[model samples]
Target chain A: SAVISQKPSRDICQRGTSLTIQCQVDSQVTMMFWYRQQPGQSLTLIATANQGSEATYESGFVIDKFPISRPNLTFSTLTVSNMSPEDSSIYLCSVGVGLNTEAFFGQGTRLTVV
Target chain B: GIQVEQSPPDLILQEGANSTLRCNFSDSVNNLQWFHQNPWGQLINLFYIPSGTKQNGRLSATTVATERYSLLYISSSQTTDSGVYFCAVGGNGNQFYFGTGTSLTVIP
Candidate 1:
């Protein structure tokens, strides 16, 4: 299991402002993913951040709204651009070491847009 | 795209009591995991059981891949166990589909 550290545990941002959440893992991981959990809702996958390329976002999610960057194997960042009140959610970063291993998640960044 | 559904969306149990949570998937999967998100919103990995059964302390999980369902058994529940339990399923890809989750409230 990898230890994932996420910054900005909680933040209150004004609408239309952008916030970049950082995720750093202690050990190098092959797969890093970003997820969003709306208030009282299940988590939804935002994108899969590749080590050196653009992220592959899931359906209903696009790069313009949630741009991602994975500069290395152990670090990644997800920026919520042009945010809105509907964008307020708990964003989480997860690291999966292998196909059969458990994916570890960061503490999650709680964002509230006002 | 796989669909994961969890049963008993809301549960209230007494401390020291036992409870069972079920996760059902719509398609075959290569990976399945159980996670507990505490009230503080920290996601804790409880079990990574893709198949068969695995136990840790009072928590046990069994996954029947062919049946397309999994069961998580919590014995002697604690007040600290009050939270949401989520089950995620994935195929050969890195993306996972998460269930709606079971909200458990263990009253002390």
Candidate 2:
């Protein structure tokens, strides 16, 4: 199994500010995914970050609001631009060795917009 | 896109009891994983059973790829087992679709 480390386990930000969450994996992975879990709700896929290529965002999510960067296979960052109260949620990054393997998740960054 | 559903949204059990959690997906998937989210909000991967069964300590999971459903069994539950269990399925796109999760509370 791979180990994932997420930075700034929790953060409090102003409504107009932006918070970027970083995810680091111990091993190189081909695909990294960003997900959001709203308060008391299930998780939703934000985007798929592939190394050396653009990220693929899901429905109702736009790259302008949730910009993602996958500069390399071991690291990825997700920035919540112009944070709002509605944007306050838990963001997590996950990686799997391949389609046949189980994916591992970071501890997650709990963001609170005030 | 695929739909994932989990049954028994909330569950309460006594310590040392046994419980079963289920996950159903609308379509076939190449990846299926079970996770437990603790109170501190950490998503812990419990199993990566895309198909067949696997066991670890007091936890075990079985996924029927042909039927698009999975089952997780926890034997001799403990207070520390209280948390939310989630099931996620992934396809060719490499993005996972998550279920609402089953919340379990084990009382001492």
Candidate 3:
């Protein structure tokens, strides 16, 4: 169980702009995941941020659109590029401790594109 | 990909009432978790019961991996428990398949 803190808890960004959301864990974790939740919708995995390597993007998600960076084990950031209204969603960060252990999530970043 | 399904898309309850949230998965799973998404959108982990039963305070969860289903029981429900409950299942790797969630509203 690690505490995950996410930055820019909320933001109102203009279209065509880009916003980077950061996830910082209190302890080192083996798996750090980024997810997007649309209004009144379920959470969808955007990508799995890997340490010392590029993020593994899920189907229908691309690194060019949502570039992720994990400089170390405790810190990772996901950038939403060329924002649009469709990209407006609550971006969440989740951390996994063990194979069968529960995953902890941050408060989430609520992004609004206008 | 694993399909996670949650029952009773919406629920309304009075304070002190009891309710059950059901989650059914399409495939085998080694790990299962339950989370509560509060009014402001913070995901709070409730349980990690892959199998057997686990209890915490007023809430408890039972997962039968063989049956591919899990149940979350809320006793003496409070207004604070009003929110969406999500059940996610993970297997073989680090990916978690999340259910659409059951939205509950407990009126005072």
Tens-digit lDDT string for candidate 1 (A2-114) = 88899999999999999999999999889999999999999999999998788999999999999999999999999999999999999999989886577789999999999
Instruction: Give Cα distance to truth, residue A103, candidate 3, Å.
Output: 0.4
Q: Which stretches in model 1 have alpha-carbon errors above 4 Å? A: none
lDDT of 3: 0.94
By summed lDDT, the worst window of 10 consecutive residues in model 1 chain B runs over B88-97
Model 2 chain B lowest lDDT segment of ten: B88-97
If scored against the real structure, what TM-score would every candidate get? 0.98, 0.96, 0.97
Chain A of candidate 1 compared with the true chain A, TM-score: 0.98
Per residue, candidate 3 scores C-alpha lDDT tens digits across A1-114 of 799999999999999999999999999999999999999999999999999999999899999999999999899999999999999999999988765577889999999999
Better of 1 and 3 by DockQ: 1
Chain B TM-score list for all models: 0.98, 0.97, 0.98
Residue B38 local lDDT, model 3 = 92
lDDT string, candidate 1, B1-108, tens digits:
899999989999999999999999999998999999999999999999989999999999999999999999999999999999999999885577899999999999
- Each candidate's number of clashing pairs is 0, 0, 0
Please give, for residues B11-108, the per-residue lDDT of candidate 3 as tens digits.
99999999999999999998899999999898888998989999999999999999999999999999999999999998865678899999999999
List DockQ, one per candidate, in order: 0.73, 0.73, 0.72
Per-model C-alpha lDDT, please? 0.94, 0.92, 0.94
Q: In model 3, which regions exceed 4 Å deviation?
A: none
> Judged by DockQ cut-offs, is candidate 1 incorrect, acceptable, medium or high?
medium
lDDT of 1 at A72: 94
